[model samples]
Target: MTRLALSALLATLALIGVATPASAHTDLLSSDPANGASVPQRPTRLTLTFTEPVPAESATVTLTGPDGAAWPTGEITADGATLTVPLAGSASPAGPYTVSWTVESLDGDFVDGTFAFTLTAPATQQPPVATTPAPPPAVTSADAAPTTTSPSAGSTATLDAPPTTGTSAPAATSGDGDDGGVPLWVWILVVAVLSVIGIAVGVGLNRRAKRGAEPAE
Candidate 1:
């Protein structure tokens, strides 16, 4: 049989060179905010890198938001030839951002694709910077009061004025005999002395009369 048909065509050319690198097909060696990139922030995650080794629930990612709105991805990991996912909320609304994908190629083949990116500024949650509650601490005159200082021009400032409440002026009663303002008891004493003097004079006269009568002198 001609050397067995040349050993069956060298065993079909060594099985088509070993099945052409195991039937190739798994190429996409770099992505991740690439592919038309113009991102100023809006990419939480959506990697891709490949060239073999991607499998584990295969993969599928989708995110579209140039206002057509459908941005939801999460849970799609392949970590070996990189796949990644996660981009769920907040930060996807400023223009261009597509990134669709589908992967399962380690020779199982299912490779889908699409890519775009240009978020130039999509992260505006700035209304919280409006916290203006700090204007209440400025009433200061040294915190409002007690600072009086203004009396200097040949200075004579005796400000003790705080006693103006009503009538008061009556305290001198206790038989008031203060000599120059003499009253009551002082007059009574003077009368008593005069009376004593008169009594004494009378007594002396009586004695003299009695003696004269007894001796005719």
Candidate 2:
């Protein structure tokens, strides 16, 4: 009986050692942009690596802005032991940002943690150096308008202005005998008078023929 009791006690002690470690909650091993680091700019993604693999659906990461407002976040993805939480929208405002994360370990236990970091407004950006486009490379006298330099007063050299061609003016004619023949109006009037005389003669001949054709009475 004494030997059996000792054996039982040893077995119990071994079982307790194994069960205690198994039932313990998971722990965070490290983080990207590490805990308490001073980042020059806000991070777009937060990474949490754990001692064991956690379920993606069971993971939740919340980002709190400097003003204590909740920052938007996208779906969290679990790849092996790493949980990647994508930050939605633009970078968090310049100041202290807080990350709070909760995850369920493979053993169905919930583990939660919190971390913080500073963002320094990206160094003021320097206003982009303001390139003035180099002022279009000063136009020289030779390049502008192609001016021809006149000869100096004491020098014998001379540059004459280029001769301009003049277009000839239309010919001018005197009114006398300007028309080569009789005027068109006079010819038209003569033709009209002749047509009237011809019509009168034809009418007189028709009346005489009717008189001759009548029977004697």
Candidate 3:
């Protein structure tokens, strides 16, 4: 009877060891966008890895921004021991953010926890520049019209006369005047008449002196 009692005690100890592990709750092992990390930009999704598998339908995640606004999340998905959920709507303001999660483990026990991270300022962007064009060039001397000059008062040619086609000798003119003087033939004819008159007078006087000498006889 003592040996039978000893066997029963050993069986009870073995059962207790098995029950202890099965009744244990799931624990979070690691996370993406890990706790206490500072990221340059907001993450698109949140992923949680646990020590044991959790049901996707029973998982619930809530994100709260620095402004105390409750951000929405998409449908939760499970892959082995990991749970992932997409973020919905626009990004939150830069500051600290809190992530709270609750899930049902394989042992049918509900577990919940909280973690926090920071969202730092992102990189800045700049704008573009403008441009302009140039102008054209100016007019040159080669593009001007042709010109003609008239003769002065000293010149013999008149303004109304048409231009001659061939070379020709210049006409004779009187000194210091536009109208001409007397001709050379007129002065020669006057000198010849004066000589004829003087000769005739000398012949007549000689005849009178000879006749007076003859009359005295």
What TM-score does candidate 1 reach? 0.32
Q: Model 3, stretches more than 4 Å misplaced? A: 1-5, 122-217
Candidate 2 clash total? 0
Compare the candidates by TM-score and give the number of the best one. Answer: 2
TM-score of 2: 0.55
Q: Residue-wise lDDT of candidate 2 within 15-125, one digit each (tens)?
A: 999999889888889997688888887677889999988899988999898889999988899899999988887645688888898999768878999988888774343
Off by over 4 Å in 2: 122-217
Q: Lowest lDDT 10-mer window, candidate 2?
A: 154-163
Whichever of 1 and 3 has more lDDT, that candidate is: 3
With a 3 Å backbone cut-off (N, CA, C), the pairs that clash in candidate 3 are: none
Q: Rank the candidates by TM-score, best first.
A: 2, 3, 1
lDDT of 1 by residue, 2-119 (tens): 9999999999999999999888888778888888889788878888888877884867778888888788878887878888887888856678888877888766779887878789
Query: Which number leads on lDDT?
Result: 3
**Displacement of the residue 139 alpha carbon in candidate 2, Å:** 25
Point out the worst 10-residue segment of candidate 3 by lDDT: 153-162
What would the TM-scores of all predictions be? 0.32, 0.55, 0.54
lDDT of model 2, residue 100: 91
